[model samples]
Structures are given as C-alpha cells and as structure tokens.
Target: MKKSVNKTITIRDIALSCQVSPSTVSNILSGKRQVNSAAGKKVLAYAEKIGYQKIHQQRFKKAIHLILFRKHKLILCDTPVFSALVTALDNCCKAQGYALSLSYIDALTLGEKATQKTISQIISDPTTPILLLATEMSEQDFHLFENAKAPIMVIGNLLPKVPFNIIDTDNFEAGRIAVQHLIDKGHTHIGIISSSVPFDSAKKRKQGALYALQEHDFPIKAEDILYLSPFAEETSDNMTQVIQNRKEQFPTAFFAINDYLALGAMHALIQHGFSIPKDISLIGMDNMPFDCLVSPKLSTIEAPIEETARQAVLRLIALTQETEQYIMKSYMGVKLVERDSVLDLNTCK
Candidate 1:
C-alpha cells in the first residue's frame, strides 16, 4: 500500500521551480498583482507539476476586539456611559482571559477612506474575534462586517437593523418603566427628556414609552417631550428653549432618556431657580457617574452594566467555539434606583 502524505505545499517550492523570487510568487497567489502571461504560465505549470496547495492559516489565539463607533471624538467625555461600559467589559475580559481593543470612528479619522485601519488589521488576521461597542453604526461599518468570519456583538441599549449579533440593555423597557415609576408615585402628568440617537435607534424607545403610557392609560401630551444632543455638551440655550416652549404644556414629573439628560436638565432648572422635586420630580436612566455626586441624587434606571460586560465576553468565547453557539440578541434587564430627585405631587399639596 502506498502512503498518502498530508502536507500543504509552499510558495517557496513554486518560486524555486519557476525561477522567481518568493515575493513574486506571493504577489501572484494573493492576487495583489498580475504577472506577465509568460511568467504566469511558468508559475501555473510549476504549481500543476508539484500539486502545490496553499497552507491552511492557523487561528485559536482566543482574543476579542471591541470596536466603538465614535462618530465624535468626545464620546467618552460627553457620555460617561462609555466609562462604565469599558470598566465592565475590561473586568469581564480579564476574568475570561480574552483581550479587548478599542478604536473610535469619525469623519476626520476615516474621512477619505472609511477603512478603520486598526479594525482592518484585526479582520485581516484569521484567528482574532470581534465585538462592536457601537452607537450610530453607518453604511461603512456594515461594509466592514460583510464577509467577516469572526462573531460580532454590538453593545447598546437600542436595537439596530444590522444582522450582526447584538448584546444590549432594553432601553424601550427602561423608558416605559421610568415613566411608569413616576405614574405609580401618583404623578398623572409626566414629562420626558428624550434621547438624540439616530432616527432608527430612537423610534422604538420613544414608542415603548408611549406604549407604557397607553397601556396604563396615562395621558402623555407631546409638548412635554424634550430631546437633548447626543454628540455635544449640554448647553443652556437648548434647555431654555425647552422650558420657554414647553413649561405649562406638560407634566411635572420627567423621565429623561439617560442620566446625562437628567443632569443637563437639572442644570437648566437650577439656573431658573426651580426647586427639585418640590415643583418637578425627575427620573433618568443609566445611573451615570455624576448621579451620586450631584446635589440631589438622581432617581434613575440602573442597567446591569458590569454583568452585561461579563456576559458579552462569555458569548464571544462560545461563538468562537461552536458555530451554532452564536448569539443574535441579548438584553440586560434594568431596575429603578430611587433618590431625592422625585417628589410625590400628592404630598406637595
């Protein structure tokens, strides 16, 4: 019986047989450049003669990359949510022994070419895995994932239309519950500080709040809603516009989309000398870093950030292991964390 050797052929073998440099052989095989017809023929003949085959690329490095879609460079400082997210993801990765890397995407950074250079490197490597901690993922971002073999998990509270795996908090439920909490406290007319995510992202959350209101039969007037900037710092002028335009039209109790909105709205209220909880009860989500440090601790919805991070790492590992183990949707539940910011209007009178 003849022995069948199981071995991958080398570019060196083809180069030597064709009397060409290894780099020329590599360029030909990688399809980076076209060789002359005569040279091409020589290489192809050599390949046929030796039954040359490409070596199977090795993987199994067991590291994951977390890519953040930072449309603005100031996402970290502007939205402290990233701080919590990074902390949670880092601790989780450490526990699981997986590596994490971050890259921000912006017009200036990826202007002429949306090729996320850092991400391109990772994708080019066959072994590494990827998770995207993204907000406002664009057409270009989708292009990056077209043929990617690595499992992609997008971390956010909103549901995007992308087909990649998503691990997120239930912002819609968060919205509904935040408003409902105010209603339970006997505030009939509740207002909201809406978020400024992209249209596709923000629609469902706002709809969820309305669904809760209608479900509970709470009358929510449209004028009471306030949306703040997602990309920029809080400005007094914007808050002033909301108050001037919407003061008497809405409820005293407010459900701000996230904690940052609550803080910015609080600053506007303070500037106008409005008493917290005495005149207006406020609720925000995400229990941001400033929540504890502020004068009146914000009554807010607390998402399980640390736990979300821990689970994301595990999910990535599993996806890498079993093809069927891939996860498409994961939502972290949220709870209300009450503080001094909200007042029972019943007690006020």
Candidate 2:
C-alpha cells in the first residue's frame, strides 16, 4: 500500500483549475491590481471551494479607502462641498491613525464591468474599511457593493431598504426649511429649480419641498418646477428661456435644489432685468463657499458636509473593530443659512 500525500492548495493550483493565469489569481487575492469582476468572482469561488489559503501580507499602518462614485461629472465636481468632505475625511482618518486613500469612479464612462473591477479591488482586502461617496450614485449602482467584504459606509446619500452604513444630510428637512422660510416671508407663489439628473438627494429635497407646499395649501403647478441641466452654463441657458417665456407669471421666489443652480438662476434673472430679492427672491441648498462670494449672497440650507464626514468615519471605524455588526443609517441635521438673496416680503409692506 502506497502512502497518500496531502499537499496544500496553492495559487497555481487554483489558476490552473479556473483556467486563468497564476498572476490573475494572485492579483485577485492580493488586491495589488485590478481583475475582471467575472473572472475574479469565479476565481474567488473556486479558491473558497478548494479551501485554498492565501498568505496575508503585513502592513505597517491601517488604511481607509474613499471611493467617489459619480454617474456624471457635471453633477459631482471639485467644488467646495467635495473639497470640504474629502479634507474632513482625511483629517478624521489621520487622527485615528488610519491612512486615507481616494478613488473616483465614473460609472457612465467606465460602464459596469470596469466599475465593478475597480470596486472589487478596493474591497478585496477585508481589513481595509471603505467610504463610498455616493452623491451621484443611483439605486441600481448600489448592487455592485452588495457583496463587499470590507466594512463599507456611504456618504452624502441615503439608501432605503438597502442594508449598509450611511451618513447623509437630512435633505428632506433642508428642502422643507428652504420652502418654509420662503412661505413665512409672505411668498405665495414659489418655483423650484430641479436638476435634469435624477439624484436621490435631489429627489428627496424636491419631495420635502412639495410636502411643505401641500401642507401650506400652496398650489403646485407643473410649469412652476423647472428642470435644469447640471452644468452651470447649461442651467443658465435653460433658466433664461423659462424666464423669457414666463416673465408675465414667474413665481415671486425660487427654491433651487443646490447653490450652483441658484447661482445659475440668479445669472439668468439678472441678465433678464430682474432684481434679486426685489423682483424674485431665491433660496438654495448647500451653503457652498461661493454662495457668499456672489453678489446678493445666496440664502441656502447647510448640508452638514463636515459633520456627515466625521460621523461616517467614526461609524466605519466602529464597524471595522466589531466582531458583530449591524447596518447603520444616520442623517445629520440641516439648517437654513440666512443671506441677502431671500427677501422678507412680510417686511416689504
């Protein structure tokens, strides 16, 4: 009788079984390089089935990965809000002895395969925590992160019914406060400047504003709601046409979904001979730095970007330390920042 030999399963064995290169298996397991999602999944499944053990690499310091997922560049840019959030996250991570790394994934241009590949690489190391800046990510885009092994947290957006850690501003409350402020100022007819891109945050804000309008018995008119392009230039052009055509019946006040849109609307109004506060009071969300620089400083609802970042980092760190974890969802409060743009109609008369 010949003695049977038991050999440890290796990367080469898994690669040959899965019909892929050893380097491919190594990259997928080590997360040193990006691998195709399909191939990676297959390789991972096979390795798990065969009980293949991979030698873990030692690292000197812990790391946190921040992935900014944008469906379109027009909506998510290097604006004050983006800069502030990133800086805050970096600071928080450094304070906790974790090195922060950032990655931007454009889903529209990369398509599903490439995006998934990049995401897989980021989540390959289960030891590293991930923070997804999902401001422009759709509900469908979330499916990719569903199977992530890393402790993941989403920022600047809310995902209902999806189990994940999230920290976002109370966009609904922000919208409600903006519109309510306008209403309290004696503005009867109000208009909304919404984006053509259907972002979850924008949708929630619009819904909240609508709720406030309905609560106050204000008539909701389809024509009053203007859907503008995400780009500032395009938004201005679109608003210009709307203002020209509706000059006779334009609303007294407009609640722009964001500060950029508000500035675009302001430009159109100014060019068309309409005065801010005097002719049309305007309010916006996201108290971006530029809001204060513009003539007739914009009144906006502060989005709590820094607070959201801090909370997200804290929760993600907690998740990484836990033996048992639960899906956590948090909404930071938003407040109205008064400025010169919105007129107090009650004081007018």
Of the candidates shown, which would achieve the greatest TM-score relative to the real structure? 2
User: lDDT tens string, model 2, 1-349?
Assistant: 9999976455557767888655456546645446568888898888767655322222217788877787888766766676667667766776677756666677888898898998877778888889888888877778888888888998867878667888888889888999999999999899899998888889989998998999999997999999999887788999888877884588999999999899999999999899998999999998998898988999999977767777889999999889989887888999889999989999989
Candidate 2 regions exceeding 4 Å error are 1-60
Model 2: C-alpha RMSD to truth? 13.7
Report the C-alpha displacement of residue 212, candidate 1, in angstroms: 1.8
Q: Which window of 10 residues has the lowest lDDT sum in candidate 2?
A: 51-60
Clashing pairs in 1: none
Can you give the TM-score per candidate against the true fold? 0.74, 0.82
The lDDT leader among the candidates is 2
* Residue 316 displacement in candidate 2 (angstroms): 0.4
Residue pairs of candidate 2 with colliding backbone atoms: none
lDDT of 1 at 46: 73
